[model samples]
Target: MYPIIRMVKQMILHRNDPPLSAMGTHVSHHRCWPWDIDLWMELNNGRTLTLLDLGRIPLAHRIGLISVMRQKRWSMTMAGVSVRYRRRIRTFEKFEMRSRAVYWDDRFIYLEQTMWKQDGECANHALYRSAITDRDGIVPPAQVIEAMGADNTRLQAPEWVQGWIDAEAKRPWPPMQD
Candidate 1:
């Protein structure tokens, strides 16, 4: 089940929080609920990714990108992601999620996020490739940045993110195609 209501709650909670730069971090708190766990009594792997949405969307809101998207009738979607899980989150345990935009290329935006336990341990971390879209099709990263009014401040994409882009470029569209 999608946690729409929980997402709404998170939106309202962080609505008044301070804004941040494109590369700055936005943090949100969440608990490992029973529904978020698996048969082994740990947070489900898939649930971890879904809950990260709660953090990323608010980060967008704080950076004012959400408003820009709404004004332009644009939308955003996750194209791909790579994540690392280093620890287990038990049901009822509390964790803080942190998200931020890391870089962007001509077509995709890259974001990095992490879930941290109260003791400052990272439970998981992920790098995401996302695309902005409109009714016509995916919006180019340059256009999205222009809409955000950050067009003049160009930043180089990080090396690791560039590496991921390079690897994806060499992958065939229909991987099964001979």
Candidate 2:
């Protein structure tokens, strides 16, 4: 688990791009293979933790982004996803995964993720959104409010992530909106 965490940290640090095959199919890699289905089964019951794993990458990216920007009020969620498996990824295969922050406003954060094979083929991609909330999951934090102030510069996000954040911001949160 520590090793996996370290690998995740390294991936976030380098902002490495996903790898792919010559034909553009994503391949799996040794370091990230543990994040796949087979290993996920060993580590979890394949129910709740599966969902958590799906959200982990984007959440990690969100955390990294907040850290880089030196902001503390931003929050995120794994609001939605769509994952397609082209082939079974084995443990020994070398692969790469990359995630980028899509966007953020006063309400939510959006992110995009992709995994690829050594030859630079796309394996999986997902867009996710989470509502921005305070640490206790109640009101929006003041820091975030300040960060989104009128005079502040908007943060640049990747193409895939932009739409998601925009959509999430427009969507109403039931509890907060009421």
Candidate 3:
């Protein structure tokens, strides 16, 4: 089951917190409950992505993206992701999650997120490509940025993120020989 209840709690708790810059980091904490573990006694890979939603949504709220999306009746969706799991996270272990938007191109926004154990070990990290959409279809990221009332100034996406974007572009959709 998804931790939607916990995610809502987080939203209410941080509702009044100060906002961050478009490229600023948002740090949030979470724990690995027994239910979060897989049969191998570690955090399930799917659960990790769901938990990442807690960090990314808060980051979006802090950066004013959520507000703009709401005001414009737009929605956000994850278009793609590439993740790496380095260390196992055991039950009841607390971890700090860090999320930030690194950059945006005309069509998509790129974000980087991580889970760091209390002992300072990085358990996992992921790069996400998100799209803002409306009834018409996918809204250009440039339009989303402009709507947020922030300058459209962009920094270079890290080499790795750019590489992933390139690789994803080469993949065929509705895959399988037709």
Candidate 4:
């Protein structure tokens, strides 16, 4: 089941936070629960992605993206992601998550997120490509920016992020066909 209750808790916890600029980072704390673990007694990879949402969604809210989406009847979707895990999080262990928008092109917004252990070591990091959409189809980032009244500052993705984007462009789609 989706952790809807945890998500609502996160939403309520950050409800009074001051608004942030579109590119500003949001920091949040979370703990791994027994249910979040896999058989290896560490945080499950899939649950890690779900927990990242505790930061990402509030990030969208702080940047006013959620409000704009609600008013414009638009929706957001994750188009792709790349994650690297380096450390294990045991049940009941606390960690901090940081999330921010790295850049955006005409088509998509790129977000970077990281999880840090209590000792300050990075547990994992992820880069996500997100798209805003309407009933017609995917909405352009430019239009989304205009709708949010955000400064249309052009941002260049970092070299590593660009490399990932380039690599993804070359990857074959719909694999394993008979």
Which candidate achieves the best lDDT against the true structure?
4
- Across residues 109-132, which tens digit of lDDT does each residue of candidate 1 receive? 899999999898999999999999
When 1 and 2 are scored with TM-score, the better candidate is 1
The sequence of per-residue lDDT tens digits that candidate 2 reaches over residues 49-103 is: 2433433443353344334233665455455654545544345465565554455
Provide the overall lDDT of each model, using Cα atoms, as 2-decimal numbers.
Answer: 0.90, 0.46, 0.91, 0.94
**After superposing candidate 3, which stretches have Cα over 4 Å from the reference?**
none
Better candidate by lDDT, 3 or 4: 4
Total clashing pairs for each candidate: 0, 18, 0, 0
Error of 1 at 169 (Å): 1.5
For residues 55-87, write the lDDT of model 4, one tens digit per residue.
999999999999999999999999999999999
Which candidate number maximizes TM-score?
Answer: 4
Candidate 1 wrongly placed segments (more than 4 Å) = none
For residue 169, model 3's alpha carbon misses the true position, in angstroms, by: 1.2
Q: List the residue pairs that clash in candidate 3.
A: none
Model 4 pairs in collision:
none
Error of 4 at 79 (Å): 0.5
Q: Using alpha carbons, what is the TM-score of model 4? A: 0.97
- What global local distance difference test value does model 3 have? 0.91
